[model samples]
Target: MAKKLELGDPAPQFDLREDGGGTLSLASFAGKKLVLYFYPKDDTSGCTMEAIDFNRLLPQFTRAKTAIVGVSPDSCASHEKFKAKHELGLTLLSDETKKMLEAYGVWIEKSMYGRKYMGVERSTFLIGPDGRIARAWRKVKVPGHAEEALAAAKSL
Candidate 1:
């Protein structure tokens, strides 16, 4: 079982490969607000919607000086395809080993259609410029979620 992260806790740092190549580290955004989100898979129904919605709001987030990063267990190649297919402008990180997911407490055992599996629980974390968690949404609903995250980011 994963422990729940609380507000004001230091956001865990990770060095993951970006979809376009090279690596991204949380430390790289030290002086900016960050929206770090975890999803189950790429190109899936809910995941696609969430990505597209976030992509649409990229300008607002950029204006607010907030950096966005989406994470999944998919390979970097898959992430590239997903981004290109949806024309996403936000950074997408690949966590093929699930290390970052586990650190963020978003990796968990889930049930669907009477089957059990370990997967990422759709979740988002807002990190302040100080690297502390400002807000967290677990078991997130896709509709209006991007807007909500943007509002929270703007507050930082």
Candidate 2:
């Protein structure tokens, strides 16, 4: 069962393969604010826009002392291709096993045109330096979402 996350709850831990042949873990981001965004797939319209938006604002996010990391079920190779194709300047993590996806509760059943299937729900979590969730957004709409997240991160 997926738990409904609340503010101040400890962010779910994860250690996953990154696009650049390195491992990134929740513990690795200790004491740093993290903007962790999860999307359904790579190379999709909405997902691409979201990734670009986040990437474009990399400098601002960096200035705020916050790191942004994107996560999806796509393999490390796929993530690398997506990054190269889009010229995205953000770290992308692969969760091929869906362990991190399940822990974050973004992997869920969805109905589309009367068909039900399991997939990622497009979510974002703002993890505080203390390792607790400061904010959580589920079923995210892409437009202006990255800017909103940046604002929140700046305030923290």
- The TM-score measured for candidate 1 stands at 0.98
Instruction: Name the regions of candidate 2 deviating beyond 4 angstroms.
Output: none
- Residue 45 in candidate 1 has what lDDT? 99
Per-residue CA lDDT of model 2 for 53-134, tens digit only, reads 9999999999999999999999999999999999998999999999899998899999999999989999999999999999
Evaluated with lDDT, which candidate comes out highest? 2
The superposed Cα distance between candidate 1 and the true structure at residue 122, in angstroms, equals 0.3
Q: Give lDDT tens digits, candidate 1, residues 1-156.
A: 446889999999899999889999999999789999999999999999999999999999999999889999999999999989988897999998888999999999999999999999999999999999999999999999999999999877
Q: What are the runs in model 1 whose C-alpha is more than 4 Å off? A: none
TM-score of each: 0.98, 0.98
Candidate 1, lDDT over the whole model: 0.93
Report lDDT (CA) for all predictions.
0.93, 0.95
